[model samples]
Target: MPTILPALAAGALFGLGLIVSGMANPAKVLAFLDIAGEWDPSLAFVMGGAIPVAALGFALAKRRAAPLCAPAFSPPTKQGLDARLLGGAALFGIGWGLAGFCPGPALASFAFAGWKALLFVAAMLLGMAAFGRLSRPAPGPAPR
Candidate 1:
């Protein structure tokens, strides 16, 4: 699809951002999260830089003009904080704290060939697959 190009470009930029911001390193991320122990506040600056650009992009996208590929924007409509959402957030936070690697940073860090990142990515994909299986609809009774 035509949108794939833009998506790839965005992903490349995101990977580049992770690289440039030193987010691709688990030790850097761990240090950032360690407020009481040798903390690094650089991630705040990274978010500060990204937030304005994202805000401007959102503002522009909110205009009536057609989206780049699709006829219109299709943002998620969910607003409620359901159990699954909360549980997922908790799991994500635990994983982040334990592994010091989220999906974005883990993928980007592969360039450095870290075994921990490889394991983290593999486990993350397996968890996603497990969730997909658990979320699937149950089979109905056969017609008599």
Candidate 2:
């Protein structure tokens, strides 16, 4: 309950940023990805702007033992890349190139992108569910 407000605020801000930065528009993203053709470099500025802010956030986080809204900071436990990581990243890049809609922007576009966003989000959710099911360990015999 205590963390709800912060979480909501962060999500709202992220969604607003996506919309304001033109990330919610598939055409804009597709244009940015089209480097050989009519490329749009505006999103580069957006990414450039985000890099510093994210860096600062990580710097600040490093000074604290625990996050403000949580008892501890849960960072990624993985050390190095493997086949699964590489495969996932390749799939993500391919999806971004083909659809011009990653998860964040896809969700942000949902309000105004209409049926297209709906279809994308639906497919994304289905993919996530399928992955969750497939990635789970197989059940074994009960421990004595």
Q: lDDT values of the candidates? A: 0.88, 0.92
Please list all clashing residue pairs in model 1, or write none if there are none.
none
Pairs in steric clash, model 2 = none
Off by over 4 Å in 2: 139-144
- Assess every candidate by TM-score: 0.89, 0.93
Q: Whose lDDT is greatest here?
A: 2
Clashes of each: 0, 0
TM-score of 2: 0.93
Give the total clashing residue pairs for model 2: 0
Which lDDT value does model 1 have at 136?
A: 83
Return the lDDT, model 2, position 123. 98
